[model samples]
Target: MASAEGIFEGRLRELCKQCPPWYKNPSLVRLYLLLIAPMMTTTAWGFDNALTNGLQSIDTFMNNFGNPQGSTLGFFGASMSVGGIIGCIVGGPLNDRFGRRPLISGGALLIVGMVIMQTFSSNFGMFTGGKLLLGFGAFIQQCAASVLVVELVHPKQREALSSFFNTNIYIGFIIGAWITFGTFRMTSQWSWKLPCILQLALPAYQVVMVWFCPESPRWLISKGRIEEGRQILIKYHGNGVEDEIVRVEMEEIMAGIEADKTMIKANWQGLKTVLGTKGNRHRLWICIVTAVGSQALGGSFVAAYLPQILDQVGLTSSKDKTLINGMMTIVNWLTAIIAAFVIPKVKRRTMFLFATAGMTASFIIWTALTAEYVKHGHKGLGIGVVVIIFIYNFFTSMCWVPLVIAYPLENVTTKQRAIFFAITLFSINVSAFCSSYLNPVGLAAIGWRYYLPQCCFNALMIVIIYFTFVETKGLTLEEIAIIYDGKESFEEAVHYVSMELNAKHSEAVSHVEEHTEVKA
Candidate 1:
């Protein structure tokens, strides 16, 4: 029996050897899976505070019509944005200086702490302070998680992998929305505060789990800890395949470092380097404009304010509101999951074009429905608004949400990546802060006319995506850099990387075959 078991083990090892390196690399797979939960939790927790509880708490204090005396409700809504701005400014340089693990762990702890504080807040000031801290923590986690995933994943799979992070964020948003609406029936404050407190579980788990996970090997290589990085790659890849994956990954890291040295400082100097040249400036503007276009399409406003909109549409029953919010969350997550699979097959430009057109059409339909409600006072208008909200989230999940996060990472080089992300986060928060205040007022004053502006924004987004946003599907980081710089065309960049990746695979196969022959 012992000999038979030994033979079975040997056969299993041989079978595994024939599999792809990615399949054999358990560490990478485990790391990817581990990140999903914490990311979802942190995102859910943060969104709960920003989009759900923050709004609910403010409404509670301000009597849902906003403060007559103009208390700190607006400030409370803006606190997260303020925290996010500060976090983006600080988190990137910290990630570059320290490793990804410390920031992730520390950020998680901070989120947990803030959520607890938020759950028990006595007054508006305490609630606002808690929100500010929560936003700061989320900012750290967002930047750290993003950079960490990119650093850890294979360059070939980077965009799709990065999209996973965005997907988790949507999932978190969905869960937070569902929980907030579900619990609201029990008690107003508890309904919202419970979700905020429940979010603490995610970061708590992340803090413990991340301790066991290894730091990004690419970061290690960048810091010139080659042997340490190699050991990690080996541990993750297993015993026999260590040297092969490490050598390739290390070469890429070294090349990136050499390229990065061209710009010594990644502060003002790095920003200038990316914008100093005419071509680089063009790329920068493309990134900036695309980001602005994405926000203006009203994705965040819809997600944060959907429940309130439902309330206004006469779906004010607690049970119905909870169910609808839950359904919306589920749809949003499902759409994002579909995007993860679809992104690999579709062109980014094509996806953006389709999504923009679909979203604009949906908004137009929604506007008409709202107008009909105002004129005729029919029940169907409520249903139409709900349908529009779902479609809005669906298109958002499918295109803008993923692209907005992935594109900037793809467009910028490593030296400029931190600064670029900082700028992007700033734009997002600034837009969010403005929208948070304006959305409620717009709803009260102009009714659904607010969506008309978004319709125009979406149309502009389609035009910009068609003309400016280049297709980046299936390109290596270096190839993407070249394409962004106009040194290569889209087709050429894709072809070059495909050939290089194919060559690398062939070489690995040959090495394995040679080893087998030697052993035989």
Candidate 2:
């Protein structure tokens, strides 16, 4: 029998070698489009971030909300995350119970209702309440959808496609930024209302269309509908042929499910079992750190508070701030899209390390430029600050943007995936909540010094990522288990399953040959 690593690599290459490229395969192309919708569920989160950031700069919005500042403003910013925290706690158990599609569709349906409520809010409490519910629904869909994208795609396309998943948030960023920029000059409440209503676009589409997509095969197999799971693999991953690679994958998934049967129970006991082992604990740690670092490492500072960051550098015109936000969205999307394509070509750990280190350096320089602009009142220095912000975004989009979801999803079991994702999002929302709640207060109170702490946080992220993050590039979701679980524990199952499947395949082929000879 081949070594576990050797078997994984050989099977992965066989899948790649036999299958036509995605564009050349009609089934793969269809599968890709279906996968993209779940991926696009993330855009709702991005739209809200950009929408609120833009709303902060609009007089009409501020006036409508009574010019919220300090804690009120912090509450407005943090409310969605507050919803996200509660939603995440429930999302995992529900996903395990009902499957991924229900959460994907149901959460989007909920977001559409919440968006309508927020769009027509009569007062501050109404708007904040709407946003809190919006966060609640968004995280539920996001938790399930992120896992579905990782599971549904053919393994040959899994790395690039899964990496492509979170980057769709940039599409939402572009839409929200440009929408707010277009509406920033309006004198009516529609300036904010229009953006809120438009947040419904992606979620509404997801709600209506998600049913058309297939349920995750991993979820199906875990539910003991093994033949149903095998058929999905043959159609999507095998392109209608019972390809060897597809057979191998089905076996691997079955083996993983069998190994994890004890951990697949209902309620809190299921979650307790997730952290019962050292490997799973390490997986949880990476998920938590990635979630927290994605928000705390100076990226959220600019994403949620770009207007204020620009104000510190002496550009106070709402028009200029909105326009710059729009432009930065374009730069970020362009960079993140490029990174998505490049993800399959590099090590996961290396990408995180490089992105965090670069972001730290960029934040340090950004702080210096902001300080100079504030002191000397130099227009050139202010422009330099703007340039540095863009540079920081470029570094962030390069790796962190794409790997945030992909890394954590690749590291855990399907049984534990939704739970781990919940934990990750819990950390993310908490970090985001802190960033959103504190950024306005910190920026207003300490000015440029607010960035000083972010710079320190970014540096610390680099250290933690280096010590804890593992490389998962080019490994199957099942094969990656060997990295955390012992090879004996993980590979033995794959090897045994592989031999059984291969023997059956050979026997079937020999029988077909004999029947053909007899007919001739």
Candidate 3:
């Protein structure tokens, strides 16, 4: 019988010789899906509890302020974003220095503590403080979980599996919304508080569950702990498949480490590294632009204020509005699940194009119907607005959520991944902060005209994507690195395996011709 290393080496040679280089191994994909499941559930709880249904629960708190002031509610809403930004900025360096498991475990515990406090808070100050803490935990998990996923998987499967984090978020949102809406009708305050308390269970479960999982193999390799990284991979995959996966991973790791050694270090080096080079600059700009576009499309605004928005559309009865909002959450989850499956099979650019186009059309219809209701007092127009809202969210699940996470990962190297994760999370949170404050103010100032700007944003996004975005459906991390480095064209980068095969064939033909002439 062949030794494990011998078997692995033989298989790898066959794979390199026979299969396309960019094809993702199935085992890596399954591992990502499994590991990300709990993290997604926890992260999703933050939004579902605070943004989606919790905002409506706090309406009484907002109303009691005796003015149309969303300042306090906005503060509470934006607090999480602020905490998330801080978390991302700090968590990146910490993950780089310490490791993924410590951060994940610590952040989960923090979230559980903060969420319990949020549930029991009797005053605004206490409630907002709890939110801040919750935000800190959420952001920590966001940065750690995403970067860990990227580090754990191969380059080809990285984007697809990372996209699952967002998919799970929507799924959690659906579950949180259902729980909030179902319970809210029974009693007002407890309805929201119950959901917040329920979130505690998730992190508590993670603290225990994550202990069973190993540290990221990539992080281990990056720290010059190759033997340790191999051990963890063996433990994670078991002896049967471990040797093959480790060989493949080690090759990729050594390449990345060697490349990273040439990079210059300085103050704000992460920022400079991303923006100084032409390729890095272009990628940085794309991430920022896409992030801003995604936020301005009002997906978060719609989510945060869904129950209230439902009420505005003439579903005034609390019970009815809650039920409809719950239904919308379910629909959002189902559609997002579809997108998760669809993303790997289709081009990233293609998904964004279809999603943005559909979202733009939905917003236009919604804006028109909302205007009709406000102007002419038509009841039927309100129904149309509600239907359009559903369409907007469904398309949103298909496009913005997945791409926002996946594209950023695609554009940066492992050395820049942590820093870029921080920047992307910061942009997302900042936009969310502004949106949380602005949505209510916009609703007060121009009614449904808030959605009109979003329509325009979506239209602009379609243009941006058409001109600037590159398709990254089937490329390996090395190939992606080459594309982002401007060392190769997108087409050439994606079809690199084919190029290699042709070169090898040509070499073989030359050798055979030379042999025939010598024999003659």
lDDT leader? 2
Tell me which residue pairs clash in candidate 1. Answer: none
For model 2, which pairs clash?
A: none
In candidate 3, the residue pairs with backbone N, CA or C atoms under 3 Å apart (3 or more residues apart, or in different chains) clash, namely none
Model 1 lDDT per residue over 1-520, tens place: 0011221123323443454656456765776666564345336433553345334523343353334322244455567877877887888788778877787788888988988897888766776788888887877777667766766665445677777666777556666666665565553555556666777777788777876667777667667786787677666544436554454454444444444433525589766666676546655776677667666777656655555567567776656765676677677778888897678778888888888888888888888887778778777888888888888778888987777777777766665565566677767777777776567667766777777887787787788788777776765555455554543232343445446656876998999999999999
The C-alpha lDDT values of all candidates are 0.66, 0.86, 0.67
Top-down lDDT ranking: 2, 3, 1
lDDT of model 1 at position 469: 74
lDDT of 2 by residue, 74-127 (tens): 888889999999999899889888989999999999999999998889999999
Comparison by lDDT, 1 against 2, better one: 2
How many angstroms is residue 429 displaced in model 2 relative to the true structure, after the best TM-score fit?
0.6
Candidate 2 is scored at a TM of: 0.94
Which candidate, 1 or 2, would have the higher TM-score against the true structure?
2
Q: What C-alpha lDDT, on a 0 to 100 scale, does residue 365 get in candidate 2?
A: 94
Candidate 1 segments whose C-alpha is farther than 4 A from its true place: 1-25, 34-38, 45-75, 187-189, 237-245, 261-268, 486-520
Worst 10 residues of 2 by lDDT: 1-10
